[model samples]
Target: MSRFITIKDIARKLDISVSTVSRALRDTYDVNRETREKVLAMANALNYRPNFNATGLVNRSSHNLAVILPFVTNYYFSAVITGIQEVAYQQDYNIILHITNDSPERERAIIKNLAASNLDGLLVAISSDADACAHFQQVIDSGVPIVFFDRVPDAIKTSKVMQDDYNGAFDAVEHLIGRGYQKIAHIGGPQGLGFTRKRKKGFLDALAKHGLPVNEEWIIHSGFSREDGEADALKLLKQKKRPDAIFAANDRKAIGALMALKKSGIKIGAQMGIIGFTNDPASTIVSPTLSTIAEPAFEIGKRSCELLLKHISKRNFIPEEVILPGTLIERESTLR
Candidate 1:
């Protein structure tokens, strides 16, 4: 293969030193803007690229951050990634993406195999419980800083960026109640997740504060999925004392429950009401637009990256929680 062009080539072509070419490429120092542009354009034309690994070796850094998550197709997570990308691009950092599909073993194995070094930090949004956090902790022990976003573990003493899931759930339930919804059933997320517990607490607390009897049969725990929503709604509707309203963990679930109820010719936003969290795009697309708690997913992702970058820049970075507040989106789903 033909030899790859380098800064040395640019220097030789421009009758300048290699150092000048390096600084020019970085647009640093007092290099003339025109010369810098020329060097950059030439490098692009020649397909010359800096070897990041070599730079990392020189700077004692990998210059790459990894973001680990369970799912990407979900609108909430996607928005978070968008936020991360925007911040990373601005900070001149590159990001690596990893997905575990909610498998604790897979999550552990991926972290174990990361081989460290070329990574500066980690942004983790876990799917499993704190019991499954050993794998995530392994990287931390190896000296790579981690900042979690969204679904974080309860035990890890690291900076976290997440929505106030408890408060968001509370607002959703309270809104339903405000609209005259009583006998409300809750379709919760997986029992293992931290956010799920927070959301469940919010749900139960809202009921208790209103003096509504906590019906054991009305609360169902399942995955954050449409099928789970459908199944839970069906189970509740079959009960002798069916709930007049449903509060789902996420918008997908809420939309699912709405579909199930609509299929049964049940009136939504009238005799029956449904509300959800996450503000998934499908919330508005559904027959009766869903009233949901909107998590600032992009802000969470962006803030997580910012925190991880801070830790990477300073080894002794103190950990803190960054809670992005959630908003309530009112629509037909919660109409009285």
Candidate 2:
């Protein structure tokens, strides 16, 4: 069997001590630059790889992070993961991804069973149905740094990074108002999520600010899915006094609403204005092209990972709440 190259071999070849080779490889300040360069050059030439297990035994860290997400099949989540991976790669940390499939029970089981010693930190966008956040608190109490993003738990006191959901929703509604769609309705996400409440507040506040009626029938809360959007849209459309515009929680729901309107032979854009959040890739491909409030998904991921790294390095680091702004992309769906 072939043997693996070790620091001892480099030290013997370079006529230096094993400790010197180790410090040189780690780039310790005590090691002279010239010697460190020589050690690195020789190590690279020999194709030597550092023993992570040995290093972890001494440092009490695995230098690996876990990213917990609802799913990665969508463009938004995939983009966020890309951002996270980029940062982790640059920082010399590895990422282990776990998908919860939007199930709270599964999320709880995953967190409860996670091996804390195997990970340096956690970056999570929680499942929508996760009402009990005690598992997360336990993780925090166990001294594992966790930074939440997008779907954060309001009850948890930890670092979080997300888009400005309230402002984005406000802007979306304001845009509809500017286009003279007075009888506007909203199709929102699950009621339990923090962002959903914030977005709904913004929607209601905008309508109240413009002296528009807040019709209870016009507001529908459901899952963040195309089918939920289609059902909610059909309900609003069948009302005795139907809304002239619909602002969906996300692009998927907006597309569903678009489908419902088309099936009913209602003219989109002119007769029934539509808008969504997240600026999902489907927004561009869908008929009429959904207008939306574009979230900084990639930035959210990058910033969340950066914050988690800070917590990992500094045990007593204070929690930070970062909210990035979103842009409104006016598309054919809202052209009036």
Candidate 3:
């Protein structure tokens, strides 16, 4: 009389035990291939759909992963989500996305009140202003596995996946030097984040390697936005000593710099060279085509999901730190 077909109905029709039918449906090692095939055939004929809720109750796993990030609309974050989807789809897992809108308070609130029973794992990209890791640590203490990606926290002992920020920034700066730009300035993000610090270190080290004096005034740290870049560039233009080249933290900032320079009638690449990190598509669309260092964003996402699954399967899994490389893409912006 039931509209929906259940595994019990298949078991009754096939003259098999309910336990055997369950094992066959699950494709357990103990269930022979012939039995599994028969169960599948019967399930198909009856149009029997799995009740994940019921199964989750018995298996103690929701098979859902949470992804918490700053902004979902950004190109880099969107690309990362694509890669995460590829793996999650293949593995029959679901993702619950949470966007904090770059708010640290919102981020903490989300993690602090997360229900452990509804999720198997978590993937995080902490906010730029997130200064505390206690909320994250609390989740881990509650027995949920977490894998941090991109904007990760330094205080937590967890798995992290990221592109090599230090080397990428080094490459961007060295490229400017190679193009015969002697005086260089760096427009970076917030001073507290790890990636920001790493990128700044790379810029400084590259300058030091080329025997250039470290101009404290030439380096500016602010929010990671196009407007921030424009403001930073305008300040630099007003300086009694302006840099001949600028290496922006990300493409958005670099694009803003380009706009500022163009308005001031400073010919890009000829008078003031520009390079940026993260090969955002806008880099190519902007006039003079901004050159940039491309981070392996997709790879970072895929690897983060893969690593989180390991933690989910094994309670004793050790934490890992993955640093992938970045490639420099040359364009008209950096050409002299």
Listed in order, each prediction's TM-score against the native is 0.86, 0.90, 0.91
TM value for model 2? 0.90
Clashing pairs in 3: none
Model 1 TM-score (2 dp): 0.86
Question: By lDDT, highest first, what's the ranking?
Answer: 2, 3, 1
Q: Is candidate 1 or candidate 3 better by lDDT?
A: 3
What is the alpha-carbon lDDT of model 1 when measured against the actual structure? 0.85
1 against 3, candidate with superior TM-score: 3
Q: Write one digit per residue (lDDT tens) for candidate 2, span 16-133.
A: 9988988887788899999999999998898775534545533466878999999999888999999999898888789999999999999998998898879899999999989899
Which residue pairs in candidate 2 collide?
none
Candidate with best lDDT? 2
Where does candidate 1 stray beyond 4 Å? 1-54
lDDT measured at residue 109 in model 1 versus the true structure, 0 to 100:
78
